[model samples]
Target: MNQPKKMALIAANLAFFIIVGFFVYQRFGIYLNNPWTRDGQVRAQVIQVTPRVSGTVIEIAVVDNQHVKAGDLLFTIDASTYEVSVQQAIANLERERVSSKGAKIEYERLKDIAAKDAGAVSDKDMIRREVNYQQSLSRITVAEQNLIAAKLQLEYTHVYASVDGYVSNINFQIGSQAIANQPILALVDEHSFWVFGYFQESQLNKIGMGNAAVVTLMGYPDTPIEGRVESMGWGIAPADGTVGYNLLPSIKPVFQWIRLAQRMPVRIELEAIPDNINLRFGMSASVLILSEEDSP
Candidate 1:
């Protein structure tokens, strides 16, 4: 090759190396400035949908993974028993009212007789009648309370969603028996999405409350979600010295030469999400805490 061509090739190679070196340096600087973690997960509030009244499910208003709003019907329990209870309560209340009315009439008649003639009605008889009337009135009040309770139980037969969320984990059918206070399904709150980043304890000093963050979901790599550090976990479950066989404390042996850093959870509250982005529970995510100067 000619000497001029050789000189030109050397110059080009040097320039290319210089450019690559500068780019690498810039990336390293960014890495040091921002604490990043791929051990992150998308989280949300999971509500256990429990039935307040126990009965056989008669109708299912929603299916698995269906989006539901607040006050939407989730399922209907067979309300035949509840209806009977309400009817029985009404009958008892009516019976009490009639008894109370009869008692009041008797008490007033006795009083009127005693007033017209001083000794016609005995004092003992008058006092007994008044007591009977008061007892009847108390019975009526008790009956009324029973009626109210029966109606409330009937209303509970129709289970409704408590919040705006998605219904999940539906394992029951129309004929399934639902026990009171037992969680039959799960509801993931749509508006309560957040991310938990398991960052190394050593990197905790760089992360603070209200620090700006960028989250990249594994499902949506190109679109980055904005967030801020909401809080940090105060402690994590211990891995050693737990109760084991024979009621003795179990301790795991550790290597002294290689010590692994403990990871602490940092909660990141996501900002307003875009229309196209869909956040789901338990999704894998990567989080980056930007430096104060780099944050907008």
Candidate 2:
């Protein structure tokens, strides 16, 4: 064939291949294979265990990675200073009560004398006595508050776990002064975890809620972790997601390349996790729908 005829033939063949490829892609091509996994680290609640009041840590009973129950004593702050404060507050409270009692007795005696007309107790004197009694009562209230604060400070010397879980990294040690709102440690819950899988928008019709999933994790190697798709998200993960970061732009020039499909996260819940297995969080896994043909 001449050059023009050869060129025409090549063009025709290219068109034919393109049409065939498009038809096949429309019918059977896997638009999204984004295999997802669910074997994540058993998450524990990171509890900020800090003193209600600032104090020196006198004793630390627990270490890192230690298992503890709810209400278990984690450590103790020195209570001697707090105990002294309590004693001083109690003394002040008692002094106020005694003074109020003395005032009451004196006022009662003066009133009796004035009524009998045996003593010249002026109206001003009576007012003074009443005022003194009220003042004493107010002092007693203040003393009571001081005593309560002292006792509460004393109780704060001891720290306890709020929930049952593993003891993570402990931040404070003996002699370390912990202020209010400071983080002491964390507690990881071991009961279970949920997997976050990112799927393309086009795959939404095939993989859906309650669809069976096969998770092939690295920990077990050949052992497959069976699970099911719990649910799909109603919203799309933004180009800039909940986090401040977004995926970098593609390397192609402005118009030459096709736009990549966006992926939405799907939550996969494990049907059952064998207790003896050592599956962990952040471990990469290949996910596949347990379907012969992709169906809704």
Alpha-carbon RMSD, each predicted model: 3.7, 12.4
User: What's the true lDDT of residue 255 in model 2?
Assistant: 50
Q: Which residues of candidate 1, in runs, are more than 4 Å off? A: 1-28, 114-125
Give the RMSD in angstroms, all C-alphas superposed, for model 1.
Answer: 3.7
Worst 10 residues of 2 by lDDT: 36-45
Top-scoring candidate (TM-score):
1
Candidate 2 residues 184-281, lDDT tens each? Answer: 77666544455566666776676767777766665676776677888777897355323333654434244546767777767767767765565444
How many residue pairs clash in model 1?
0
lDDT of 1 by residue, 186-234 (tens): 9999989999999999999999899999999999999999999999999
Model 2, clash count?
4
Each candidate's lDDT (Cα)? 0.95, 0.72
All candidates: TM-score:
0.87, 0.62
Best model number under lDDT: 1
